[model samples]
Target: MDEIIQEDKKVFLYLNNLGDPSFDQLWMLISSTWIWVPLYIIFLYFLYKNYQLRSLVFILIFLALGATVSDQLANVFKYGVARLRPCHDPSLEHYMRIVKCGGQYGFYSAHASNTFFLASYLGILLKKKIKWFPYAIFVWAIVVSYSRIYLGVHFPIDVLVGAFAGSLLGVIFSVLAQKVINKQKITP
Candidate 1:
């Protein structure tokens, strides 16, 4: 486990060092929630388009709740694992170029968790309607996840675990959302 973890750090540093100052702002924007307003609006539009007002309300509420759960779960892992972020780690502090250092712990990134949670949720929700949509959603999730490492705040493993956790949470929540929809008898 220790050797594998050491290799993961090596991979993290390699990926983190791949960033250039010229593209920092672009990545920072991608990693930011504020910049994703349009995407959220689009999601709302899709929900509204597919369901009646009451069903939309239930879907939106559960979606938000699921996202919150995913984010909070990552936070728990961060504090529990107590792993220092790459930017905060002493051994590699000098070797990396970081634009945003962010919080002290980076065991599993909330950004990765939240984005992938929404992606997986929305992706699976809309999978039947749009044939190719789920792939696009997952691609978007991966790019956003990569942005965290580019900003030098998270390790590769951090994002990987986050992706996995968020994906699982997403599937779980989507199932819950489906149950709510079924109980409510929401027809798309």
Candidate 2:
């Protein structure tokens, strides 16, 4: 396992250091939260105004669950696998941006996981009222995941896995919430 991780790190170092200025610039542009904050506010306002209080509460609970699950899963993978980040590996030392150096193991990105989870959970909840919500969520997830890679804090694979794991958790929570809502008989 250690040998495989080392080999993967070597490959990532070579690929991630392509040093394309345009790519870097694009990444920087997408990574800014100025765009995300407005979108978040709009979504929150819509949810608060359009949805019933119970539904809003359920969605918030599911969002929290998704975030918690993502965090715990990231910690488990980071410690259990013990893979080193590109910035931390001596072989990849020259390739790193240095400023974005993070923890030793970067197998899974918490940022990507958390953002993706929130996006997926909210996207599902808002799918009917806002037809474009899912697309926006997907775009947000992609941008967030790309930021992790562009900042030299995580490899592409790490972000991809984090996104996938987060999406799964979001779906699970959504389904559970639906079940609970259906089982309970609400009075009109």
For 1-188, candidate 2 gives per-residue lDDT tens digits of 66866666665665566557657766665665576678778878878876777777776786677778898999899988787777787776776664367789987877788778877777777788789878988887887787777667787778878888888787888777766656664211
**lDDT tens digits, residues 1-188, model 1?**
98988998899889989899999999999999889899889878877776788777777887989998999999999999999999899988888888899889999989889888988888888888777878887898999999999999999999999999999999998888888888978776
Give the residue spans of candidate 1 off by over 4 A.
Answer: none
Q: Hey, what RMSD does candidate 1 come out at?
A: 1.1
Report how far off residue 62 is in candidate 1 (Å).
Answer: 1.1
* Best candidate (score: TM-score): 1
Backbone clashes per model, in order? 0, 0
RMSD of each: 1.1, 3.2
